[model samples]
Target: MSDIISVGFIEAESDATKCFRQLQYQNCPRPGAEVEIIQLAFIILGLEWNVVDVEKEYGIPPDMGTQINSTHWTGMMGLLSEEKITMVLAIYKIFLDITPERMKSVLFAFPSRYFQTIYVVRKPNETVSQNFIMNAFPSTVWIILAATFMIIWLIHILHAIIFCPKDSSIKKVFYQESGKSLMQLISANLRQTSELNSTGSLFVLNFLYLLAMIVILTYYQTAMFSNLVAPSYYKIPFRNRNELSARLLEGKVFMTDIKRRRPYCAYQCGDLYKALEKNPMKVRNTDAEVFRDISNNGVFQSKLDVNFIPSQFNWFSKRYDKIIIKDNLEVTHYTAFAFAKSQRKLRKKFDQALLKLLPAVEQITTAHGYRTRRRPFNPIQERHFFALSIREHFFQVFLIYIIGISLAFIIFLVEIFVYSKTFKNIATFLRLKT
Candidate 1:
């Protein structure tokens, strides 16, 4: 009976002596099988392989029932896929004989790591391209606009300084002295005017100077009114802080306590009256009586006596007597937006967005009952109780001009009187000498 050979497996690097020992223990194959094992080792190591002439060359027995399998080859192929090995020599030797379809199948079965190497190999010129288009005209336009404004501003300043009454005060004084030098005149008059200090004269001079300023300012304001164009940007409707504070108190009627301090709040007297009436629970401090009197009287009555409460806890009410109490509240709307330099392509889109959003913003604000002014409060109507207040500035300027002309005439008369007296004295002395 033939002996059954059981193959023994060991680690790939096991020594030949170890293999022999294991084989001896197993009493595996006889001497002829040992020669076959040596031949199998040569075939597995790639030393030589010719299966067709195997019997002819070695005279080996046929069908020895020996089969050989190598796990090392399987592990090498797995490492190639995982490590993305793409050496040209390895490819030519291992994969050159493989069919194109079979090659593709093997490549597809690999993990993404193998494909990463394939992509780098195939597309050497691939890169990301970025496009940047910058529009610059809007900035240029703004620069031009700013320059134009500066030029116009310079011209207006020059005109105001050269022709405006306020700026010409010193020139007017110098011109009034006629041919006499100021120093000479002052020296001569020093003894005569000893009892009169320069302080009184200085005061009078300043008063006249301010009066001239008032006239010019009034004329400027009146001209703006008559033009109907209204210098919207330059015209500061309020004359001073007192008026501003008064209006702020008035806005307290509809505003929350916190809103009263806001820069844009109008604080009109009428609004203040209404606010006080609405919020009775709101504590009024020391100024409550004064606020009540102003609310009832529908007038600030006296600028000095005006009362102020903390905008948070206290508010001003609308005056019952004033038409604004029933009329549309006059408030100014100020709007601001960011603009890019000379960028016209996006200008329309940006403007459209603003127009769309502004209405919604206004709607939300209105829905919340936030009081916004339609236009600046008319000082004339409030102060004078008549449209005549609008023209008051014009009249005031005209009065100032009249006063100036009168003073000039009076000075002319004094010069004439002084000259006549000096000439008479000279003539009398000459006649006595002759």
Candidate 2:
């Protein structure tokens, strides 16, 4: 009978509080990817195995080393280097970059699975209510509309000056006819009868202007209605590293596991790396702390926290509905098992076993909700579609309506002050009486 191989397993801190336990053999409701791979490896090798907690046993963390050359090995690497454990089970080779020191210290088995870094960011919620009308059309569309309005107004002014009955100065023409032209344009757009008495070219221009207004208003009204009914989709805050750095500058905390953080920012250069290094507190010590930060909208002093995590933990992003992921800045890596450099023969045999078991591991991973294709991140919440809350959905439209009413009231008061002959007559009568 083969001797029972003592294999050390690094327990994931995140799975500590999970109802579905990790690193379990019998009757485990949900054995994670690592445990699943270990179980398959043991079954294929036809060997009895004992699982040891490398982190709990040794004060060292699973994080091998941040700096390349180290006299001493720490964590699972230390245990493996000393041959305390036969081989560390599921020592993710991807977590730490494959440095020359690491390659020399440990034997990496055939890569078991592929993984990449994913940036999880909060969907931006802050939108300007005053921009509701402007946002109905894209910036380019609004610009075109404004340009068209100015052109039409200018043409009307030129036509009025050219066709005036009496000789008038440039200032007199603009003052006497500009107000009338603007009022006619406004009245025409509102489907009211335009008081524009024109004959030849001016008449044709007026007709074209009215037709253009019809088309413009048609599209504008359709867009406005759609905006009122449809769910509001905010642009993804940041997709690339540069944009992410800008967000970090805006007080958004960057979150990552304490163990894996060193490698992520190991480049020791670039704005992103520097930004990550600035926030030490963001490197969460415990899994519970990380989970809490992610779940609670990542609100650190009213700013959302951005998370940099492996694609494996993407389920956490899905779990917290508010969390959205951007894979544009993903760094792909092939992960493998780590063995002590002394155990070359064992490592070879383990590699052969793992090669055969990869297909099965993939199937198990998919079964455990780790799909090959990741779920797409959407800013629009699901509840927005099914449950139509007036306060949430109609707030912009309601605010716009209030603004229009307030503007009309202000205009009515302005008219009373500007052109109310009755008010002037009443004041004169009162003065005469006094």
Candidate 3:
């Protein structure tokens, strides 16, 4: 009986394990049937197999020790180097850094599916300014808009004075209340009914104001809708590594230890890996610990946390909707089985068998969900739009409606008080006259 080791670091086993497990259960495999690679490879070579899980024994995933000059090797790679096991069942490319020391120690075989490393971070929230309505447009645009209103008011005043009746009083012609005119002009701009009836220059000015108002309102509404839907690109503190690095320096954000581990970092991450290593405070021992901290911090503080994880379909589960998975930042890598250097003949034989069973292995990978599944960098999905209650979408509209209704009620009360006082005065005068 050949000893095939059960070696999976993460929650699930690699596609190879599924291929072998499938073969063991069924004599004649169905189309697209999943099989466990290592055990199936040995079984096809006419050998019985026993399984052992190294991760279970050590309470840690395997690491393909670093460099040629490194004295120590550990985990599944260490076991393979000493020829203690027949084969490491599910050694991923991430766990094995292809270095001179590692290459000399173990022979990689049965090249499996490719997967990518992705950086996940909390979606940036749109923090609306206190004066958001005014801030919607720049100072220049607001100034121009205000000037347009003033010009329209001035045009009306000029027309009223110049075209006044010769028999009319000065008070009726020149007594243009500036405040009332300004309010009416504003109402007209808002597409509301206003007392701005005029002709000639005043007419042309109103026409111009209407055109300008259309443009300004269109732009303002679009800008507001965009901001409400998603945070602007400039407002999003970090999008890529360069921006994240800047934020890190300012103490606005920090990266998790998920990708900072030596095996995972390799030569791909470069400076970022070095930065992570220097900061021990960023380390979270497990995935749950890392996720829990990020979830807790996200609820209370606006501090955006960055984490590197492999792209998988299951990531969408739990509180992961708030975590934005960046597709642009995806780094692809292929996975394969690792074997002892002494077992080159066995590796060659297994490789041949595994090649013949590649279709079956791929089917199992898909069935077991080992394929690369990514949630594209979409603001709506990251914000969990579908998960939100309907009330959230219309909250702003409802709030405005409530405020308007309250104001109308207050105005009604004030009118009642004023009318009641006038009626009482009239009745008293009538009684005194009688």
Candidate 4:
């Protein structure tokens, strides 16, 4: 066993690096080194250790052998070139911008870990009623259906009104009955069939009425069932950067807030950064600003764009359902332990220790509880699990219920016109009670 070597670490406040700042540093000496999952392995491997505050001793750029902290893709290259620390404890890959210098400067220890990233989206500002109205009566399909039925009904009613035989009270009564029945059909209530008393067009009118109604009910039930059975989802999910750029060029979505945020990988990805910067997406600083555009109908407008985000933050934002990860736009950056050019033996020993501990570490941490493994990663989301509600799914059903109530009201109006005697009788009974 080598003597206690100085382990240097960078202190970052974000959730990604918070694990080292909290768990590992707490067990180590005062103002200890930043550590990662590999720390447990280092301890069990029987390696003596001394904590070195890299930030204070060497600075981020590392003045002497004191600093070993660099989280950037190329941070290790600069530190190793200067012979600051013998190895890097935690270096994350932003992208493989490797050059000849990196090739010669360091040896990589084994056990690279991967992370999952997702996009966060704002919620739509739609009420339950609005959602029902929007989903039930889709413009393109519903308008065409309503218009087609209206034209057919128009021809039927006009024959009774204008083209009826002159001096026929029966025809006049027929027109009134037909108009009232048609109104009920518009309100989407099909139980008014027994009230039809027109002679010639009775069978034809009933057939058309029921047929058009069947179409409407079929569509309504299908939509409601789809909403209830399958999970509610947006058809167009947020895709890769290229897809976003295309959407912007086509003016499908505009920026809402684009003040500087955390490191956006798109800046390193390609032309997407420039394209978006030309008309960068705007951002919402408050909840009201974020959801302002969502109130129009139930569909949330594509307002903000997240270029780079960790999965924990994305989950904590609770926008996973609305904004999805770019499944096809998988940009993975590799993270590896870094060792100095002369420390091949140490690097080889790290691989052996890692092989013995990584699987066990992952299992133990995961078994302790999900949060333990990802303790510092998504602290915000984990704490608020109790705040979740079924309303996220039930909003669709709630909207449908509101529609049903509105339809019932319209049907009530039609009933008063059709059954004038019953309403008058109720009024008289109410007066007697009063």
Best candidate per TM-score, number?
2
Residue-by-residue lDDT tens digits, candidate 3, 1-434? 14543333322434444443344356423212222455566668876655454555555554543433454467667667667676665433334434456666678875555444444555556443323345578899889877867777777666676777889875656555455667767776777776647666676777677767777788898875554555433134555544444555555656665444332333445555444455323655677766665554221111111112332211444555455443334344545677777778877887898887777664554444444433434343332232323455456556778998999899889867868988899999999999
Q: Residues 125-229, candidate 4, lDDT per residue (tens digit)?
A: 223222443566678987887687777566656666665667778656575857775775565444343444456665577666767677777778778544334
Of the two candidates 1 and 3, the one with more favorable lDDT, higher being better, is 3
- Ranking 1 against 3 by TM-score, winner: 3
Q: Please give the lDDT score at residue 217 for candidate 4.
A: 79
How do these models rank on TM-score, best leading?
Answer: 2, 3, 4, 1
In order of listing, the candidates' clash counts read 32, 0, 8, 7
How do the predictions measure up, each by TM-score?
0.19, 0.69, 0.58, 0.54
Q: How high is the CA lDDT of each candidate model? A: 0.30, 0.61, 0.54, 0.50
> What's model 3's overall lDDT?
0.54
Which residue runs of candidate 2 sit more than 4 Å off their true CA positions?
A: 1-4, 11-36, 47-71, 90-99, 120-132, 138-180, 229-231, 252-263, 266-269, 276-328, 365-377, 380-434
Put down candidate 2 lDDT per residue, 314-403, tens digits, no spaces: 223445444434344444455567777677987888888888887776576555643333444455543234443467656667887999
Better of 1 and 4 by TM-score: 4
423: Cα error in model 1, Å: 5.4
**Cα lDDT for residue 339, model 3?**
76
